[model samples]
Target: MKIGLFFGSFNPIHVGHLIIANHLVEHSDLDKVWFVVTPHNPFKKKSTLLDNYQRLEMVYRATKDYDKLSASDIEFNLPQPNYTINTLVHLEEKFPDYEFSLIMGEDNLKSFHKWKNNELIIENHEIFTYPRLSEGQVETQFDGHTKIHHVKAPIIELSSTFIRKSIKAGKNVKPMLPEHVWEYLSEMNFYK
Candidate 1:
């Protein structure tokens, strides 16, 4: 079976995430998508991250109703600085029956070169990209991953950063994530 791996912190899973996963599963050849919850992303700011397990649960809550979507804790058991290459290797070894691909946003294209063993990633795996707005500029650059292509999901500007900022500012972020995820975040005081 062919599966798409959507890797992220998912501090709190949001509607935008759901949209992209839905698009990939419905429109692409992928049979399923696993939301690989990274315990620590090499490129992200660690200070702003929520607890790994908490974030994992939020992703679980958000995707529970979708049969094609799953939450992965593979990064949690792996070493720190959760690199995608290592995770991909592990998943391949663990699930040899499954062929894995990547899901990402197009704006982060330039940084793909900085990803550990990224050349292997581009050469071996298929990548599905979505457009993202960065610094008031809409960047759809594909970088050099010719294997990478844009998905046709509805444009969703929602972001985890935006949701986190709203939570820290004492604003209601319930509308950004699914109802179950909102409940989990509220009950756990995740962002605060």
Candidate 2:
């Protein structure tokens, strides 16, 4: 099976996320897209994120109805401040038969060269990139790279940061998230 790893902190799994994953799985060659909920992202501040388990629960509720989508807690058990390279290695050892690819936004692709052992990642796995309204340009070397596929998924401008801030301000951002995820967030009084 060819699985696309959509890694995110998922402070709250929103509909924009689901749209991207659903688009990739349906439009691309991937059989399924797994939302890999990171316990901590190296680029993000850990203090601003919700509990790892709480975020994972939101992802679970959001994806439970979709057969092609699911939640993965693989990185939770891995070392803290983990890099994509280490997770790839561990996944290969555990699921030898399943071919894994990366699902990323154009913003992430712009800084791909800086990731740990990026050359190894590029050589081994295919990258499925979606458009993101982010600043900066992609590295010239990655342009037209055979291993990297630019998927024409919808450009979802919605962000978890915006949703969190709105919720904290007592604004209704329910439409921004999955129904169940919104319910969970409201019930827990998260980000309020």
Candidate 3:
């Protein structure tokens, strides 16, 4: 089984996230996409992130109907400041029968050098990157032995950072997230 590990904070699972996961499962060779909800991304500020349990629940609610899309809490059990390499290693040990790949934005590719044991990860797993507004074409134009694939999905100009800011300001975010996500946020008073 080929599983594409799509890691993110997913402060509140939104439509764009789902779209990319759906696209990968349908268009790529991946059999499923596991939304690895990170407990704390080493590169990002912990204070800005929502509780891991809440974020994971939102992801579950967002992807409940899609059998092809699943949510993972693997990082929650791992050590603090979750690293991709460590997570991938853990996944490999737990599910040896399944092949794992990475699903990320092209912009993240630009900063690949910064991730812990990044080169080691690329050497072992393939990468499936989607385009983002600030992302560049270096990932494709300057390819390496590392298996990197570029894909086209709905470029919904939205990010979790933007949504968090909107919620903090009490601004409208109907378009930022899916209907069910919005309802959950409203009902729980998250980001208040």
Better model by TM-score: candidate 2 vs candidate 3 = 2
Ranking by TM-score: 2, 3, 1
Better of 2 and 3 by lDDT: 2
The best candidate by lDDT is 2
For model 2, the superposed segments whose C-alpha errors exceed 4 Å read 41-45, 136-139
TM-score of each: 0.88, 0.95, 0.89
Compute the lDDT of residue 107 as modeled in candidate 3: 81
Off by over 4 Å in 1: 41-47, 135-146
Model 2 poorest 10 in a row by lDDT: 132-141
Using lDDT as the measure, name the better of candidate 1 and candidate 3. Answer: 3
- Which residue pairs in candidate 3 collide? none
**Per-residue accuracy of model 3 over 1-192 as CA lDDT, tens digit each:** 999999988987888899999998999899999999978655676686778888988998888889999899998888876678989999999999999999998888778878899778888999998888765466533266548888786666677888888998999998778777888899988887
What RMSD, rounded to one decimal, does every model reach? Answer: 2.7, 1.8, 2.3
lDDT of 2 by residue, 1-192 (tens): 999999998887899999999999999999999999988655676676988899999999999999999999999999877999999999999999999999999778768899999999999999999887674355656999999998888888898999988998999998899999988998999999
- Backbone clash numbers for all candidates listed: 0, 0, 0
